[model samples]
Target: MLLKRAIGVAAGAAVVTAILVAPASGAGQADLDSAVREAMLAERGAAASADFGTPVLAEPLVEPTRSNDQGWAFGTTTIPAPDVEHAGPHTAIFVAHRQAQGWQVELDGTAEFVEAVERAPADVVSEGEKQLFARNYENSRVAVADTGLGLPWAEGVAWWMGGGPHGDSGQSRPFSSLDFNGGNGQVLSAGAGRVYKSCLRNGSGLVRVVHENGFSTTYYHMTGLTDLGDGQPVAYGDYLGRIDVGLPCGGSTTGPHVHFSLLRGDSHTKVDGQTIGGWTFREGAQAYGGYAERNGTQVGTGGRITNHGQGTSTPTGVVESGQNTSVNVRSEPRLSAPVVDELPDGSVVRIKCTARGDFVDGVWGRTDLWNQRDVGGWISDGFLYTGSDGPIAPAC
Candidate 1:
């Protein structure tokens, strides 16, 4: 289900003047601007503090545009860092939708809002087109590896079957539900990645992690949670939370069990067509009936698996101090690969893949500085430490 959180608008006659005035199908630039300003004011007032004064929107919102197919508009705004709670400049994307009365604040956040906007087209367009676009994007960005996944629970923990291989029935998608023998069990991340969402609300508690390889794994029906926040990096075998069977955590579950689902992409909209370790995930399939093998060895099954090799070809590494204080990120994987950007000491980067390059100190590691625009190149493995021994990440 799409989680909708209502934005609180301050009640006042002056505030009413800022209400959005737009057509039924689309919002004009003036309406969008008014909506953005009003939403920012409300958000700032809600986050105000005496020590920090009042948070004000930085002038000149970025990427102010209306939705192509809906009565919605969005803009990215910058909030200057203050002296109190929020100490750094923060960026937010605000969304406003038209209503019978006027335009109102709908949603605001970072990538999540971006995703919501992307999915809005599906509401007006054909579902087939949406699925096709999703598949195309997945094929372009994702390359599944043959690494086995670690079973989410600890060893010797016997879990009963709560649900298995369900089809797309309402809110439930393709997933397996493992019921804890004692009404609860420890839930662990299926692989190493960043915690995308740790949302617990509306009778549902879940954790979604985006793996280095562009795939995402979700664990739902959790009760106790770890201290991991959104966008926090997590290592393989990290404990996420505990499973619970009842309401407020496990949404509409009959028993206490963790619902696990491997996805093809980071967004929830791209959950279909998931393929892990070369096995295509199917709806209504048995959780334990399927099997995956690596080099003729039975490594994982549909139900239980290890996080051994279930990641993308890209490996995450940190920029260590080389002969220089910073490393030059190039457009390609060689010394002559045209420097695109520079990475300071202790900077974390994702190595898209290794390439046989101009050997420097017996190292030939290459990476694409994905986070930085116009930055990508190869760095010597001598300066890039992947925390893992040998090259477990796939070759480019």
Candidate 2:
């Protein structure tokens, strides 16, 4: 949707006035999405269209994590662009207030938004909410030195260190992340804190955990994520999500693995010389070229590392066909493929990922999307309800 805005003088300062349509009172997700898009376009002007194209919200709207009785709301949104320069989506932390005219959006990093949050009355914004926003603001500006985080899996489980220390943005500097594969596929909370989902759309998204020490961790390329709401508390070893090749935030991966990174506030911090999951990371003078050491055992990239964090059970979902029948599991995505087994209606399924194949009309309507089960072969997604009309898992 095309949006227009005017930069005008208000009280001798710059203020953004929406020239396009404004969201009415009690706006829904689509309205808020347009508001965010307008704010972004106003800030970037024509450059936004030339570079990133039109911004699209990654997920449907949920309840505001920070809001008050005065119709003031604060939350974050992920706008995934088609541009390739950014490894992921652009995260927008915005403040919205309802006025006699309409809803207005003010993004972070602006003087007006900062002052408004700081001086907001107790009734408008609670003390705890203010502190949380302050922490988020501070973390984005400063780099954290260390954290007490551990592996994002169960204790004593061996996981392959597919890629060594690398940039969280898939670049060279700020080696803030490491990739892990070949475990139970269950990703657990590294520490106790609150969890939030980003770039979530059609049942797929990335997870972030904010710890008590003002440190946060990011988990990417995951599927079958938790249903927990934003700002929900989680204990160490709680089930966060499952590792997959899914790129819900716009990126590419070779296999099913989790890109784990530590953050101080919102900024990615270097993992070099930092101890995590009982191993110390050392950079190898190049990205994806590092080794982890623990008690005289040196594990280089492609080696397996023992997880010392708490573990959780694998997540599974039931296959729904509506009719009291079964669906054939094919050896390949096509219906012509040989049938290997059959899954009874309402049977549990551990789905690995999805792939394009023959279109089938079944319980959930017709679609060409097929789901590959962890146990073996493929099944028509039309027969299995995964909570979305579109593909929820990564491409297989």
The RMSD (Cα, Å) of candidate 2 is 16.7
How many clashes would you count in candidate 1? 14
TM-scores of the models, in the given order? 0.37, 0.58
What is the alpha-carbon lDDT of model 1 when measured against the actual structure? Answer: 0.45
Residues 230-256 of candidate 2: C-alpha lDDT, one tens digit per residue = 766788889988888777667577788
- Location of the lowest summed lDDT over 10 successive residues in candidate 2: 308-317
Model 2 per-residue lDDT at 86: 31
Over 275-369, each residue of candidate 1 has an lDDT whose tens digit, in order, gives 34222333334433333332233322223322222433333556666567887776766677687677777665665555556655523244431
Clashing pairs in 2: 154-311
Return the TM-score for candidate 1, rounded to 2 decimals: 0.37
